[model samples]
Target: MPTISRQGTDFIYQQVTRFISGQISSGVLQPGDRLPSLRRLSDRLSISVPTVRQAYVELERQGRVESRPQSGFYVRARARNALMKPAPCRDCKPAPVRCRSLIDRVYEGIHRPGVLPFGIANPSMAKPAAKGLNRAMKRVMARAEERSIGYAPSDGEPSLRRQIAYRYLELGGAVEPEEVIITNGGQEALSLALMAVAREGDVIAVETPTYHGALELIESLGMLALEIETCPEEGLMLSSLRSAIDRHDIKVCLFASALNNPLGSATPDEHRQELVALLEAHDIPLIEDDVYGDLRFDGTRPSPARFYSEKGLVLTVGSFSKTVAPGYRVGWLLPGRYEERVRTLKRALSCSCGLLQQMTLTEYLASGEYDRHIRALRPVLEQNAERMTGLIGRHFPGETKVSRPKGGSVLWLELPRKVDGGHLFGQALDENISICPGMLYSPSRRYRNFIRLSFGHPWSDRIEAGLETLGQLVSGH
Candidate 1:
């Protein structure tokens, strides 16, 4: 075995992890193969045994290898199998959105209690962040002001906006408090952005197999959807987008700023800049959903599309629902050039976001614990994701392809040719397991064999059993 050396920027543990993972990926280390003893590896690599032990611990957390009681670490049988990335979609013209009938049923399953939740793209409630948020809510309620009970400004509370803007600056984006508009949730912010930019019968551009909510929003607004082929790793393809724009008059483009739903792809910084330029060249506005940006597995957060657009064409809608407090329903939008339009829409649609919730969130953010909370939350999410991915790899069919997302708590799956995601959805629910069928994520019924599974809930025997049931169902057992 080749020894580890401090030849690169990676830490000793990270280098060891890459070396072992690479070995597994190359099939040099077969399933159930015992890893070299810590002492042996330490001597071979001229490193400490503690470093080797740490690498093994990290690998176990990644679900690539597991420690057997009184035995050495062994490569997991499932981890030996490679997962394929989601295939790129082809260029297509704008068409009226045709939502699947199963979409409503899928959501009903997600909301229904007693069902194993692998459907909704929510944050893990098992984290301590929930308790922190609850305390914040109680604090606001204890000091209840008449203003707290009253309607807030349609644009949002100045304090909350300033806090959000400050957070934006941390991500290397220059946003002013006045540029932010608080909305009920990310969905509402997106709705306002859609309504602000396009009229009935207009065309909107979006990624293929995107968040189902976006497709529904487009349909509800009486707009046609122009599906752009998206990559599982890179997000929206600029070439596909440019092609679609050339063929059709795309009124506005709605995309995920990072960790897009379903596929969980984060558009890189350079790609984001290109996207901004593309939208600016066409003079079309971009509405970006960045709810998942903060949930990145990596500690560093990605920049919003607003960071690159000099023309101020990127309207970013984000919510604490995915990160901080779901019930709080606190979300905000930096509408860029359309700030006034979104503010006006906020007044016309609903007076404002809930005042008490906004106050609670303001206190939470001001406490300066929000960053600490997220830093702790990200690892839990990452471990959960790894656990789920391993489960899927082990249980699902050999032909199954799953996304290995760098961030986000959801996993996108493409099952064997014989499997039907809609039927699987129904079958899984019959077993009290809820999974999002792939058809709902797209305007057309393209990914009928695909599905999205959430690791937002804590991992347990119940979740394991639910996944086993899905694997059996997929295998037609």
Candidate 2:
């Protein structure tokens, strides 16, 4: 029985919120446990009913609790088996990426008809903006008419570029429309940024278990990738980075510090600031892979790493593929000092992104539908993450550890040491389930016992069945 105090400076609802949170933290109220009725809690705490309701509403907003129709609030199943220790990256060194063949096989499984897609990381598909986007596209076509089909400028459509810049402004960062170069998607944005900054054989420092696409890009460009130790919680470890910098002839640092793939670790703003400062001090450029920056479960987007750059060495990449529509293939780059080089590369490479997609997205943003879609999408992703995590806990081996994502749509799992992730991927594929093996994520072939599963799709019985099968396989049952 927790009591509220009026003498405290905090608001009454806030105090109530803290009290309930403390109970949840201590397991005094377990997952699936019903919370006290609002009136009952009000009477117990000697507070007004409205204050209690406010506290519950706040909790609901935080994804800590849920209210049933005509019923009171109940605790959500948030039993997080968070990866407690950073994976070891002993003798970290630059090496050519060697996982392309396996990556090809994994992707093949992803497109196989009737396969349960736990391999892909496309979050927007979980609750797609199909209707909204279609509506926007129709509006764009109707408004722009023949112009929508015409070639957009090599740089990008001016209206779409302004929208991208305006979003950065909303995030407390200043980005010029001219600084925005629309690429085919985030991958192209990343490729252009990398090309603008570094060339063949340049050592690129990356988080240990990094995105496979980045590694593939490095491999394609004939660059070496040095592994940097990254925390499962906070993202890139500065100490490991500093040491790597001291030892290697590292030319560039390409990191998904905003929200790392697989691990789903979001670096705090202060950490990102330090990262930018440290890299800029060493005169090494950072290509910030921020494709998932807008998909945080809490709906609070983290500031792009470029915000803290003093030397203009931070090049940030953003995309609508993960947020709105993957096939739209709309993404932008803030190339900092390398804007001219990136623009030239963009023109030389793809000429320009799809004109219709750009016009459609610009209309989506201007009509306020983009923001509303994002707000609605975040909760679906957060709920899906919760349900998947809970099911994994219920079904997987007791020793299995999973990443508790702050946002995004994937869960990184560390299975038993003896379990081969590659073998598991093969087995899962045979069962019509596609999974991303940990080997594909690293240049040095770390995470041999790990695999990443996506909860990005709409939840269904098939997904539940797939997890159970995966659990059985992991258990050798």
**Predicted structure with the largest TM-score when compared to the true one:** 2
The Cα RMSD of model 2 versus the native structure comes to 5.7
Q: Write one digit per residue (lDDT tens) for candidate 1, span 180-299.
A: 899999989999999998998998888877899899888888898877877877777787888778778889999884778878788887898899998898899999899888888666
Give the TM-score of each candidate.
Answer: 0.85, 0.88
RMSD in order of candidates = 6.4, 5.7
What is the lDDT, from 0 to 100, of the residue 282 in candidate 2? Answer: 88
Q: Write candidate 2's Cα lDDT for 247-356 as tens digits.
A: 99999999999899978998888989998989888899999999998888667789999989999999999899999988988888889999889988999999998999
**Backbone collision tally, model 2:** 0
Clashing pairs in 1: none
In candidate 1, stretches whose alpha carbon ends up further than 4 angstroms from where it belongs are 1-88, 126-128
Most accurate candidate by lDDT? 2
Indicate the TM-score of model 1. Answer: 0.85
Q: Which 10 consecutive positions of candidate 1 have the poorest summed lDDT?
A: 79-88
